[model samples]
Target: MPAAANLAVMDIPTPQEALRKLLLERLRPLVETPGRAQKPCGMQFRGTQLFSYCCFTTERIAAFETLQAVIGIVLNGTKEFWVGNSGRRFSAGQVFVLPAGTKLDVVNIPDDRRGRYEALIVEVHHLPPALAALPELPQPAARETRHDVTLTAELVDALSHAAHTLASSDHAEILAEHRLAEVLMLLRNDPAARCLFDLSLRERIARMVVAETTRTWTAEAIAAKLGMGASTLRRHLTQDGTALREVLATARMQIARGMLERGEANVSTAAEAAGYASRSHFIRRYRSIYGAVPSEHLAR
Candidate 1:
């Protein structure tokens, strides 16, 4: 067997597990150089050569520089990233690719005063020239464009699954290379995929805010947590056509409704769980948005 093939089937059981374990092992030798953050579940490993992490934390400032390419998926939460001379923001259900030699920084902002945010990060050595040589992607002129390419959920799920599979070792380098190629092909067809090859700053803030009517948060507190001046944050979001408060309310109501439908919690419980301080307040918002009372909606 080829050396990589031999390494592939060695002692691993499932393909997914083997790939992840092997990556962890390989990364073990490189932890000292560039440094690594704590790994979240589903992230196989971190090493000097390659690293991945998933984070859901209160708003804070973070910065890093890499000599390698980085691809990130924002599964749930908003991230504003600064790359070299450009900056871009991404929200839940979005994906971003950063080229090698890019200086990157991210800050998470919560529409509600809750200060909760999350994202996934994946970094690999520079894309091979062969990969970069694929046909150029067309995008709106940077001067007129405001949003980065939005990746479909299907593509995101596929990439996530592939990354999980790669964490296992059942495949040889050829197989691994093929899987990576598949991901590149998907990006090639996506309008937003060009950003992966050429590094640029893209900014995206949430179009909607989600807040619990019952929970009260001071503007100063919210502004400080997001690392933005209160006035500035409000102005930007307002210009987007929705007030921050409206976004927060919509988000919380959606969560409440989902919980109620799942039968995981009753009206009162679901309301509070969704960040309402009082059942009455929750019910009021719920009725206003859904045209039915929380209990009535749950009954169905």
Candidate 2:
């Protein structure tokens, strides 16, 4: 070979060849899955409890609280994430069940073969309206362990179909709502999925109120879902050392705080979503609970 050709071959480093190929291949699964036409890079979800979808993000999120009860699925890479007090390592194709207003400490979003931290997050604001008869919930025989580590395959499939048929943004929004509701319905009803849910009456009702923050919630309606009368429900909550109004207020503020942290909603938007008739009242209460005004979260 000529001297120049020898130099050219030397200049091509072999060590990084695998990484280069891996980087290039990252663009392959742009859609949620195979046999579909999507660039995975730009897919977005909009809907009911599962609020929105995001492509991979490099943004570092530390000890930030989740806006509402949320369902997060990691499509690629590993995530060191926590919901409430449970801390565990989550791998790809795993699901996360974060409690409403749970402070999430995301240790990090790993950069790996799957590219940046790629996952889907849906904020749950509303659960299905109560059925006339709830299934007979099993009493706790021992300590009930919360489970966030569940298979993400079914969830990934449902979300994939939802995104594949996304027409308009408006349509996308509607699609998310029904599909998420469907998923929640399935989780609530599936005997096998019982461990993945938080079954405490207060916690369950609190999640429901947070999911439907904009609507006026009544104790009677919540009581119906739990298969009890309003007075009995109140008595139960009282025994649990909480009240219906307290749960609503806490859920609202936590939801607003999460929105503020992500810069997704303005102070006013958050207030409205949290069901405050007056922005001033929202601001005062937000500061009292979260230790800052809503807008301050963005600045922080």
Q: Tell me, what's the RMSD of every candidate?
A: 18.8, 9.7
Per-residue lDDT for 164-185 in model 2, tens only?
Answer: 3332355656576666655665
Could you give candidate 1's per-residue lDDT for residues 1-300 as a string of tens digits? 667765544553664344433433333332222443533322324322223433446454545443235566554457787656677887654557765444567676643442345444554433334664555455555533444544444454556554654555555233545555667667765555555554321111111122223445555555654456879777867776766666555555655675575455798788776678899988887888667788875734
Candidate 2 pairs with clashing backbones: 30-39, 30-40, 31-40, 47-177, 48-177, 125-211, 125-212, 126-211
What is the number of residue pairs that collide in model 1?
23
Cα RMSD, model 1: 18.8
Q: Model 2's lDDT to the true fold?
A: 0.60
TM-score to native of every candidate shown? 0.41, 0.64
C-alpha lDDT score of every prediction, in listed order:
0.52, 0.60
**Span of 10 residues, lowest total lDDT, candidate 1:** 201-210
Candidate with maximal lDDT: 2
RMSD of 2: 9.7
